[model samples]
Target: MDTQADRLAGAATGCPYPFHRPAPLEQPKELADLRAEPVVKVLLPSGDQAWMVTRYADVRALLADPRISRNLNRPGAARISKTNKLFQDPRMDPDPPEHTRIRRLVMKALTATRVERMRPRVQQIADELVADLVRQGPPADLNETLAYPLPIRVVCELLGVPVQDQQRFRVWTSSFKSISGSSEQNRLALDNYMRELIETKRKSPADDLISAMIAARDEDDGRLSEYELHWWSRLLVLVGYETTAVQIGGAIAMMLAHPDQFALVQEDPDLMKSAVEEILRWKLVGSSVTMLRYVTEDVEVGGVTIPAGSSIIPAADSANQDESVFEHPEVFDVTRKDNIHLTFSAGTHFCAGAALGRVELEVVLATLLRELPNLRLTVPVERIRRDEKHLLESFLEIPVTW
Candidate 1:
């Protein structure tokens, strides 16, 4: 009924929120002031304005708030990116009973138990990658050799994608996550590939997520639709591969950046769990900002009235950096016991693959520490190139030596 422009017609124009970093590993300077206000009107990259919620409590609360919806394809919703359709995809904004039903069936197939069973295979993958890295000699691009491949293979196996086809899948997923002009083309290619792969799985079923979903789609009750299966497959590969891949690269770089903290983990490999948690809490894994949630009704957040049909960004990165919730929030401590961060988000839309990501990170960290204790960055942390084009904030290359 109401447009975002109509809702903000008389409101004061706010400062442009800087989405790009002044430097790699540095939060945008505007974040400090924005977090103080908690809720403020700001301009987005797409030039549409929306409310940004940055305080930890407000963000955590708003994530679970029923008044907000992730269906950003709505007419009045703020666009996060001009070129990327990742958010605009209908699969990104599944409504009601459909969302509930799909999540239920997907969760059953992607349980913590199932992920735990994958640990040994995941660890073996890490070991093989590391051994290959050693043989390739010093000064290797860790992101290319290990970070990206480990999770790509893991996701391929989990989805029953053939080993020979993983490299193409990797290229397609990379394109799917990119914010560049070619992203749309790559997204369509990946979509077509998933559709064909689903058909292949339908004929020759296997013990994998795709096969499981196909069976669900064929049930007499018909719980999952053909549309849902294809989109779900694409979504899983994107989240399962790219998100974890970026986090793995970020986690290692974080440890390498803080030598003292890195030493603590190295001295006591038992601290890998805490280290991974701290990394998730500290690093802005996926993007400079989180996804947008369209307000379904007039809601008061942080003492500000956001009208219905408005767009709001719950800044999870800024939330994790809030000083009130975390004592000395800027300091990266590996052994911090009380660490609870919203990196994976909260409430009903919390990341489904969070457990699997954690396992991959833990296995990577522990295996590296044991096998290549001398692993260190070949270049300065600030010198590491950050991907400016992709929605995912990952390093262009993580050069390392053991």
Candidate 2:
């Protein structure tokens, strides 16, 4: 792999190639155009630094490299200043040390075994939700009824929120996250919301992740600060639903696109495993861009030299679509022999919610596949639309006639 620094100094000028990997719904034309350049470089609206890593190999190497820290809390790190509450919190703050600590605590409550235990409940939710849709007949908005609600339901249970309160949580949860939002307003609202939830949980605890974390923090003799716990709780609640929402909707859309593959999965329930993996790989949700990294030390990726502190963005979306890794990468093969996609990522910073996500998606898809045996898309593929601009890469509205 070549380091970005080894390439000509003036490579990615003025969004040269503008080679950012696009949403599953849209591919930026510059993706291929930027092949000649080391990586795409462009100044942000606020004069921040950014470089889009488009090649598969470079993206993987950069993401896995320790020198490239996930810790956005480092000094001179303006990349994360794009958001207020985001990098300010330990979650998106520093890499290692604090990042490791917060991740461990969250994972303690969210392990693969723990997540798997919730599958039956997830399937139960799926059944009831799908039944309502079946009664309603065709022309149902799958995104609203299915995609959005399913994750919300599961996460609500996981976090011990009363089911009826999910909608308020959703609005409160989304306010801070939106890119177009006023940072101070969203942050204050989020803090207020989290503080209220924490106070409520303190008065009356439940058998859920939030309670467990509070207990753990106490037993450790105050290893977790009030702020950390609050931030963790709010973060877990929102993140638990956000990515899963993207994957579930994306998976169903992928399945529907290929009728034979969709039918195959519907027939052989075992095939859902491969089907889900394929769906994650094929759909590159564009808007959820990982911030470009500041390479603390010089490094080589995809045969390019990256200088220290350069804004190096790993193209997870691009790596998932790489041809060498998956046979017929673009063909949407449900039974792909080698499905080692970087969807969950790898190493210490791997997504904490992945196991839970897999379980939720698998259960919901299984229930939907079996129940709506004749389920099909009501809208044309073109009209189906993909949310390239927003974070979720959502379907604006998935119109399904099941």
Candidate 3:
């Protein structure tokens, strides 16, 4: 296709930074608009009219619709510029054929078995972080101490990157995550870091991701180029922690606030799986952006017509809250059945790190409850500050005390 439709160009009135916050967790303004009209055509800043499908059923159908393309490389693509900060990803820019290749390469390392095997290590990391928290006492910053660091540490291990350089790694990630930095500068900083790291890993074999990538590159040609390997490692590190950084805090916040649910998870560790799913659902993430989709053709959707060349947002957060598909969608019940929440998304583009994320959340959050049996927020629930302005919505500082 010569043209790429940008969703950012469409006509719609929603939160500009939907990834951060919107009309509270249980209530999204779009839900009501959707009920009134399953597909609402709205104008975007770029002057394009796009369809915003709100119903759970409709959203899922649209996501699975083969006509809904994810390629962002089209001529008119609605680029989520790094400055946008609306998404932790801009790599969503590639159209299929090209996109499929990068995605397949990513699938190699972010495999289900690798994530599953790392559970024990993740569990240990969680314990170690919390142990330090205990030493520091209540009124602790979970965001700085746990939410952010845990994922960084895990990804570092997965990439075979050294943890001894924790300060540098933290600074690297912080720059990318910074709301104030220029996108080019952050990208440059990240590129430089990855290049240096890759060179180091190449010269001397290590036990982390870079070393593994080098081995994998040698084994498979055209799969990972030197530049691709560099970017891949950087992308892994960046995407690896973006959502998870929020989830780590969001998971604990969801459970702690819902004592009954938290108690159940604490009592039966097996329930950790369900608890994590529920957390993924209830997370107050994604108010403005979603897994962006481009229409490959004109498709009739839920009594509405979506024309070809249109860009769309697969609002997983809204999809997760659809009451028709989910009974009591607003309730924070961990026992919800047959939950196939699309938080990690569905279809061919399903999150490569879905399994890894699940293991990390389950092991870490479960351990927190078990070790700090009396854990409670040091600050008022309502008073807790969330980075509602960024793509990853999370507590800026979840102060906790036991």
Single out the weakest 10-residue window by summed lDDT for candidate 3: 1-10
For candidate 2, write residues 192-284 as lDDT tens digits: 877887778878998787777776642443456687788777777767876677677777776776899988887788898888887777644
Which segments of candidate 2 are over 4 A away from where they belong?
1-29, 32-38, 42-47, 73-85, 88-92, 182-187, 217-222
Q: Candidate 1: lDDT over CA atoms? A: 0.80
Candidate 3 wrongly placed segments (more than 4 Å) = 1-29, 42-49, 85-93, 175-183, 217-222
- Candidate ranking (TM-score, best to worst): 1, 2, 3
| Clashes within 3 Å, all models in order | 0, 15, 18
**RMSD of each predicted structure:** 4.1, 3.8, 5.1
Evaluate model 3: give its lDDT: 0.68
Q: Write the candidate numbers in order of decreasing lDDT.
A: 1, 3, 2
Per-model C-alpha lDDT, please? 0.80, 0.67, 0.68
Candidate 1 residue pairs that clash: none
lDDT-better candidate, 1 vs 3: 1
